[model samples]
Target: MSRNQQIWLGELIRCWKALAPADDNTRKTLAGLVGFAWQPPVDQREPEATPAPEPELPPPVAPSAAPPQPMTQKPKEPPPNPQASELPRVAIEEEAQLQAAEWDSVEVLNPPQPHNRQYNNLLPPLFRPLWSRTIVTTLASRRLPIGFVDAERLVSTMAAARPVERIPRQPRWTTMKGVQLLLDKTPGMAPFLSDQAALAALFDDCVGGEALERLHFFDSPLRGVVIGGKKAAYRPPQPGVPVVAVTDLGLGAPESHFNRAAPGEWLSLVQLLAARDSTLTILLPWPAAAADPGLQRCTAIVEWDRSTSATLVRRLLERICG
Candidate 1:
């Protein structure tokens, strides 16, 4: 309590106060050292805070509140063509040209070969002509039967194959005339005539000189010749041309007048045998049972025109060469 002591005490208290937060002992020392009274803080003061209440919300709306909707839009379509579409002209023309360029021109041939024959038989069996089955032969064993059969079948089938002049009644004496009239009068006859000539030329060409000599002819010098004896006569108006005639069915004689006889019947048997003449006579009709017809009685007088036969042979040769 002296003045010095009090001053010392004041200094110590000041030091203690400075160091008070270091320890509890430092606080007690600071209290003892200080002459004046002082107290340490004991309790912490609480901080004040306030929060506001939330406001009430309205209920959610139903699907009915949404706006009415339209269907989804479709993509736009292209406009329709006013005119119908067609193939291009170039394409059409090209197609037509292709068809024309590829066309085939095959032609048929007749009197088919035996082994390599195109047709099955001489005549179509189901529907056949009367002459298809007929056969004949001359007195010298020359086969007129084959020739007549071929010629008649050729003529008949040709008539049937195409539109031809049809006579209501075909007479025996008038066949060649009928044929001539048809050739002269038919419409579109050019193609048919040309075709026929070409066919005949083909046959002629196939026959060699030796083969031509094989054909049978009756040698005669006259405007025409008689065939089938005294019953019938076929005269080719031109010299050296051949004619055809059939025997009269009613003629009862074994050598019917129509079956044999002719003008200029003086040719040698060899010449007649050679078949070089143009006129040819053949017998056709099967002899009746009571009367048997033989070829020895059948004869022909064929007229000859050297120029015509040569021409026929030459044409035949040309065809054969092809």
Candidate 2:
């Protein structure tokens, strides 16, 4: 190559070396220009090789110096499965087709709503017909008839002055006392919300709103209860008024419940109900087995269920009243 050509080529190669990526063509071109030999950088020429890990040596075993023995025959591998080709193959994936629902098979019923007249009540069928009369029988007080004429009083008035103390007339159990419903609004009584509503309706129907009263309490009334939306001591209606109290008597409470009523606490309440001028009847949700024995003796406990018939309530009330 000419001297000028060599100089230009040398300059171009140096420029390429500084700016361009590594290429064999540049080295070749530079070699032809002035016998230029390309020498790679020291780092590219020799690289530090990572040592391969040595294979774990077998545990030291004593070498046996036995004489050479005849070679044993090698066991052949098992033949390929003959039935593999004959097996039925299933599709790897199938395109699923959605079918229309068989809505005709199902009967869609538009049931009568709760507010509808066709709606059947949870109250016992036999109860509504018999409870008003049955309760009257249970709670009626023995008093002389209003228009009763006393012969002794008439004779006393005819003979002496002022009728010598009004003649005592034979008492008749005919007067129907008013009623009050004491409802337990505690956690234990939550399940009986519907039952309470049914009972309230039943009582309200039996005795008009004027005669029917509702009171609220927690687990027990020993600590008092809610009266007129304010905390007040729980007392039944006035003398001759019957009170029907719906309570679980702490039987529904958990074992570790803090407000669970003790047998003595229940006894005190029962004594108050049965002994006081206000008569109380418990509509217990639990079975008779868990009932307090003292409570059983004090007042009539009627299980609030389909099993509790009018006859059963009448018998239970008669047992307490008689």
lDDT of 2 by residue, 1-322 (tens): 5565456555644754454423446544543344343332212112324665656877776568554442332235357478844755332111100011111222222333333222135644423444534543343332334445666657767677664555545445443555777888877887777667766665665565677778888877777889878999876567666677788988787677787767787667656766655556788888866787877887788776556665677667666766
Model 2 lDDT-worst window of ten: 92-101
As for model 1, its CA RMSD to the true structure in angstroms is 52.6
Model 2 alpha-carbon drift over 4 Å, by segment: 1-175
Q: Clashes in candidate 1: how many?
A: 18
Q: Pick out the ten consecutive residues of candidate 1 with the lowest summed lDDT.
A: 176-185
Can you write out model 1's per-residue Cα lDDT over 11-89, one digit (the tens) per residue? 6546654563344455444545443333332222232234545546657778898655423332343563555245356
Instruction: Say which candidate scores most in TM-score.
Output: 2
Error of 1 at 72 (Å): 52
Candidates in order, TM-scores: namely 0.17, 0.50
* Residue ranges of candidate 1 with Cα displaced over 4 Å: 1-235, 252-276, 288-322
Error of 2 at 210 (Å): 1.3
